[model samples]
Target: MPDMPTVSLNKAAPPPLPPTYQDPQLLPEPRRCDTGAGIVWIRKAFDMFKQNIGIWLGITVAMFAIMMVLTIVPLFGILSGLVVILFIGSFMQAAAIQERGERLKFEYLFSAFSTHLKPLLILTLLYMVSIAVFFILTFWGMHLLSVSNFLEARVALDSVGVSSSKQWIVMLYMLIAVLPMILLSMAFWFAPALIVLHDMAAMTAVKKSLQACLKNWLAFLIFGVVGGLLSIVLMVFTLGFGFLLVMPMMLLVYYTSYRDIWTDQPLSIDA
Candidate 1:
């Protein structure tokens, strides 16, 4: 009988290509969008708002009521930041659910609490710290400017009919000082969505959010300008009550922008 073909088991089949290595912590690289993409974000957000107007209004009312209650309780108002973070995450989650063709539910407003409470809280803490640092630095810088002869120069200029009031100078200083805070806001803009959707840590989420915003600064600039103008119009036409509507729409825009920049599929609403 032909010698049984010698079967060589010497080589374990090369370890099945290590199951496609996937990093659980991997995050998407933020995309740089065209400047006009800002307007597109608003349009998409508006479409989402139209689809769930009733639920959106209800969530807005609930948010206002809760925030009012928190504000009424002495010292508890500080928790408002945490509440806002949770609400933001919930809004992102709701948008995702709605994108799946499901009807929006009021309960979505509180859903983040169960799944992402800790990270949301951490975000709030970081927010508070940022505010504190802003104030501290602003005041300290003002003090330095005040003592550095800047005030004297202003006075001399005023005396020369330059019409520079100390109040105006301070206002200008404050406006200039707020530039950094605006950047900080950009850093934090997408953090809640990142935390809720990606399960990213607070710090990591903030860093990524900032990078995303910086990469799309032109788009954000357009967004800011258009949003500001729209807000003014809404406020004027509706006697400030428009904020209730504006607030929800703004949150939708936040979610839409996050989806646009970080995910392969952006949220869409049917015409």
Candidate 2:
């Protein structure tokens, strides 16, 4: 008997993959927010702040000190912004824990350092790069303005109480500096939460953040305006010590906004 010929099957080759890397996509749309949601965010933040003011204050101070130290380090100093990213998750965790009726502890602020280090560090680098670009463009614009004598008008608006050339320079610098920072802030606003809480990649989280903000720009504008005014009033009335209390509340507000805008279900307010 002749041996049967062995059968050879040619398996279909896997399709070639695309060369470009695609960013992680977010939900089709963000949760809808109303104008009143902005105020509600501040209120909820205050509630969270009240739950653990001491712990919150301590965490803030410690983080501030850490940031200062990082900024002073020789080579790593430029990455100090990245250092701040390391703690953003911790702060959000602390807030979430408090919302869950748990006692806030200082250790909560360091929790993300253990698990989310890589993405957070990458985010920090991107954040730092954005800031660097912002400043570079800001200074360059100012230089161009100065060199071109663009602002050399004899009459000053004096609307914001500027009278002298020195004042004009300072005011002009500030005006020029604000636009880029505003853009950068909006773009990165939700990136930390997405990266830390939702496990998104750095660039993907950034795109989601920007998308979420763009989808709810009006609410954000209201929040920024009203929140800023209220914060100023609080600080002024309390001779600036109020800022310590308000600072944590503001961060919580930011986190709350992220939750409200990004989460699908109705936000649960801890009783």
After superposing all C-alphas onto the true structure, candidate 1 shows an RMSD in angstroms of: 10.5
Candidate 2 per-residue lDDT, tens place, 1-271, comes to 9999987688788899876633223455677688667777888788777777789899988888888987988987866666677788778777666655567788988998987899988888888888888888888887887777555632454545557567666676687788677778888888878877778899988888887887788888888999999989988999998878877888887678876888653343441
Candidates' TM-scores?
0.80, 0.74
| lDDT, candidate 1, at 122 | 94
lDDT of 1 by residue, 1-271 (tens): 7888777878677666545423223236987787788888988889889998999999988987998899889999877656988888888888877876777899999999999999999998998899899889988887777789687758776887876877767776777698888888988999998888888999999999899999999999998899889989999999999898788888899888887788776543221
How does each model score on lDDT?
Answer: 0.84, 0.77
Q: State residue 5's C-alpha deviation in candidate 2, in Å.
A: 89
Candidate number of the best lDDT: 1
Cα distance off (Å), candidate 1, residue 252: 0.6
Candidate 1, poorest ten consecutive residues by summed lDDT: 18-27
- Give the candidate number with the greatest TM-score: 1
- After superposition, candidate 1 runs with Cα above 4 Å error: 1-27, 149-172, 267-271
